[model samples]
Target: MLQNTLEVSVVKNLDFIESGVHICVVANQVVPNLAPILDRNLKAKRVVLVHTADFLQKAKDLASAYSNYQVKTEFFKIQSAFDIVSLRKDMQRLFNFYAEQKPLINITGGTKIISLTMFEKAKEYELPVYYVNTDDSLSWLVPDVESVYHLEDRVKIKPFLTANGFEVVVNELPSSNKLLRQVLDDLIANIDGYKEAISQLNYYAYTASSSLKSVSLSENVEGLRKLVGLFAETGLMKIENNKLIFKDEDARFFANGGWLEEYLFHQIKQLGSKIPKIQDNLCAVEVCKKTNSVKNEIDNMLLCNNNLYLIECKTKRFSKDQSPEGGVSSAIYKLDTLMRELGGTFARGMIVSIFELSKADYARAKQYNIKIVSLSELKDIKRHLTSWLS
Candidate 1:
């Protein structure tokens, strides 16, 4: 019989006791079923078995089995519904019992509610909760536990004394790595299409601008409207208050400085002889100050040739740091006003940006026939001009 499998040895130890000796027994049995011992330990006290909604029937079955073992077990039903009221009520009842008897074995394996409720109640009563699972294929218990045993078909055990806050080690858990990789690969593949679309749109905008001999501000605005419309149709950009607002996800590539400058230069050079060329050292002056108050410190101005091409470059960065937008905008406004005051002697008006232009800005620039280039396409303009000069 199972009882004979154990060898029990009793020893009497007499320390400094006056007239009594304590007897201690060491038993080597088929992993001495602690269920019976634990039940006896809670003899006259309240022993509540907190169960989740999903495993309520299973817990009841386990309690019935324990009855045969002559252990007194009381079933405490805990609901695991998404409803907040029911969950709160269940927590209240569990906390009340925890304050009274302070259970030894708190099982939480079936549902999230069990873990959530037990986690709160365990802190109040300082109770030791054990996760009992029917699945033996994997060990659900956390490490640091003293010992574990298999009871019939169910996995049972008492964990080591854990602190109030314990974090689960998810790295060791089994997961679908292959599926995750496949999903990531598919996402990257789809993003390539957006990149290509933006490239085509940039090319079209640049080519259209370079083909113009000398455009007025009104004509420039019209051109921008056409470009913005194209972007909206192709879903690369959206129109908001005459401005091209990039969808958040696609904003990064559209704001690429290198690409914008290259496209701008390419289109400008394509203009050929339509744009007049003043002498190389003709003093190309850039007025970078705002229009309202003229900072007549002419020495601070960046000098170019008499064929001065004033460009206002705009862009937005993720940081709060000062971007080129404010400086560039202020510079353009002041220069334009200054040139107008000087009887339109300036060669040309231009606006360059690392960002897509808004409908209003685009229209404003077009109305002045201001040439625009993206930051990325800037290098291409110089290269195109070099070829023209060659």
Candidate 2:
């Protein structure tokens, strides 16, 4: 009986012939999956990417990440992509030449027909066939009951981004920004009764017409006066004669840009610091992305375990009658774009808003793999952050 299960450590120790290689028939859209396979020890002398001419640049980009290993590309015609017969012939030809060296085949990507044809050939040649699971882990596809092997590491986010054509700026959290942290901790500590009040206060901060002018607390909120007092007590802003005043730049910064972002950033940093076995977890605030053609910014980017957690902060209220063009939807769109560009499908997105998301918006967020942490979840953000990374 053949041993169908192989541990990652065992697989890495396998000896490869001088000309042996790992062949992957990949498409432009599925190029992200290639990273995991390459990250794991495949016991191959080199990597041969089978892709179309349109994805040649992407293939080369993928190749650049593995400088220690030889990586190269071979083009196939797009018109013949779904033609299984053509793919089979190509596989047969490849097998005829590489059979002596015993190359491994990964049927993890490409069109359905392409994958099917590759599967057939892998079986016919009695070759090793593998697939990368959704979580960027590896497993065998041919065996009825296969052993699941998790690679010890994943490609880091910065390299992954650079390889995928994103020019990223590494922005570090300022060491001198402890005042905002103190204020944020105070706000969360004293937020029991003042949830709505804090939200309403944030509204005022966000909408204040001028930095010099004190913004009047709305009279309609049930405990509007107490909320203003709490803001003053927390040292977030000054209050006199029932108007909320920004005493200095820090007060104005938290009020307008959002205390919610500061709070979440604080929690995220704390979680990353205390967590165990995290390869690399770093926070970058206002990290800018510029390629040859476009420019965009991320509010907070958490890079951990070679995956990206993109967080966008919002302090505004979302409408019950949610439209695709509404604030909630726009945030999701922005996060999704950043994910695709920066981390491909491997990136996870999150929006932490002091406001609540409507049912429609929540469902839309779930569909796009964008997690939402709204007003209700603010109290237990640490748990949410832990579960999100887990």
* lDDT for residue 376 in candidate 2, whole number 0-100: 60
- lDDT per residue for candidate 1 within 292-379, as digits (tens), equals 3333311111112222343433333223323435533454455465435321333345565444444555455555545554433443
Clashes of each: 35, 0
Best by TM-score: 2
The window of 10 residues in a row where model 1 has the poorest summed lDDT is 157-166
lDDT of 1 at 15: 19
Residues 1-390 of candidate 2: C-alpha lDDT, one tens digit per residue = 323343333333334323346777655444334454455465544666777666677666666655424455444334367676677788777767665666677777777787887777666665666777666566766432235756555555555555665545644443336655675666666555556776666666655556634566556866545655555555657666666677665566566645665567667667766764244444444344433555666667766655777888766565554566666877788789878877766788988776666777788999889988876677788898888888
TM-score of 2: 0.68
Where model 1 places Cα greater than 4 Å from the true spot, the runs are 1-47, 52-56, 81-85, 132-390
- In model 2, which runs have C-alpha deviations exceeding 4 angstroms? 1-20, 28-32, 37-40, 43-45, 67-79, 96-101, 122-126, 141-146, 169-182, 191-263, 273-292, 303-308, 316-321, 337-347, 356-364
- Model 1 error, position 217 (Å): 99
TM per prediction:
0.24, 0.68
